[model samples]
Target: MSKLVEEFNDYRTRMNEVILSKNNLVMKRLWNLDTNTYEEGALDKKTKEMLGLVASMVLRCDDCIKYHLGKSYELGVTTEQMYEIFAVANIVGGTIVIPHTRRAAEYWEELQTNAQ
Candidate 1:
């Protein structure tokens, strides 16, 4: 795995464990809701993930962007498709989203490299 990818996964996992271990009902329910929302519904996982990626980019949440990018890649979203998604996000989010797009592109490259 790429160092960036590894680091992100590690940090996310560690923090999630710490958070969940606290046994907070609200947090647990929120986590469950997020997981269930992305299941193979009528939208399909790939489409949902792509939508998630766009929303994350528009919202300027790096962690959410990376999570959605990883899920999109795992769901077999093509690079070409991702570019279209990026374009939509940039169009909707305007100039402020460009920086997030740059990071997203970098993360996508790392994912592709790791796949090979």
Candidate 2:
């Protein structure tokens, strides 16, 4: 598994053990209400993912960026397209995405045989 997925799963396991509800409560509320405003809005999936990368960059979420970048590639996002995405990030969010870019590279290096 990608480390991002593993980490997220590990976090989910720990959170399940804690019996404390958090982090996703608000999103859950939205989910349960069937109000996928974000999903239903103007953005398409690939575009949304690109924006997700931008948000991850702004939030300095290295794992998130790594995860999304991999998924982005799987979705046929080209390197040049990613470069364009990076240009957008640089213009709007600046250098915060650098660590995420590095994390994405490392995660790619660590990718196994896709057995997971």
Candidate 3:
């Protein structure tokens, strides 16, 4: 895997372990909710992930963007669809989201490279 992708996954995993080890009920429940929310349902996992990517971009959360981007890629979202998602996010989020879009593109590239 690319260093960028590997590092992100490693750090996220380590932190999640630490956080979950605390045994905080609310945090655990919230995490569980997040997990369950992305399951195959009325909307389907792929569509939900696309929406997640859009919302993450608009919110300017790089981590969330990366997470959704990874999921979207795994779910077989095409490059064309990704660009469309970016366009929608840029439109809804305004110019402020441009920087995030750049980062997201970088992360997506890393994901592609890792896959190869």
Cα-based RMSD of the predictions, in order? 0.5, 4.5, 0.6
Q: Model 3 over residues 38-83: C-alpha lDDT tens digits?
A: 9999999999999999999999999999999999999999889999
Model 3 spans > 4 angstroms off: none
Using TM-score as the yardstick, the better of models 2 and 3 is 3
Q: How many residue pairs clash in each candidate?
A: 0, 0, 0
Local error of candidate 1 at residue 81 (angstroms): 0.4
Best by TM-score: 1
Q: Model 2: how far is 110 from its true place, Å?
A: 5.4
Deviation in Å, model 3, residue 113 alpha carbon? 1.3
- Collision count of model 2: 0
Residue 64 CA displacement from its true place in model 3, Å:
0.4
The lDDT of model 1 is 0.96
Candidate rank order under lDDT = 1, 3, 2
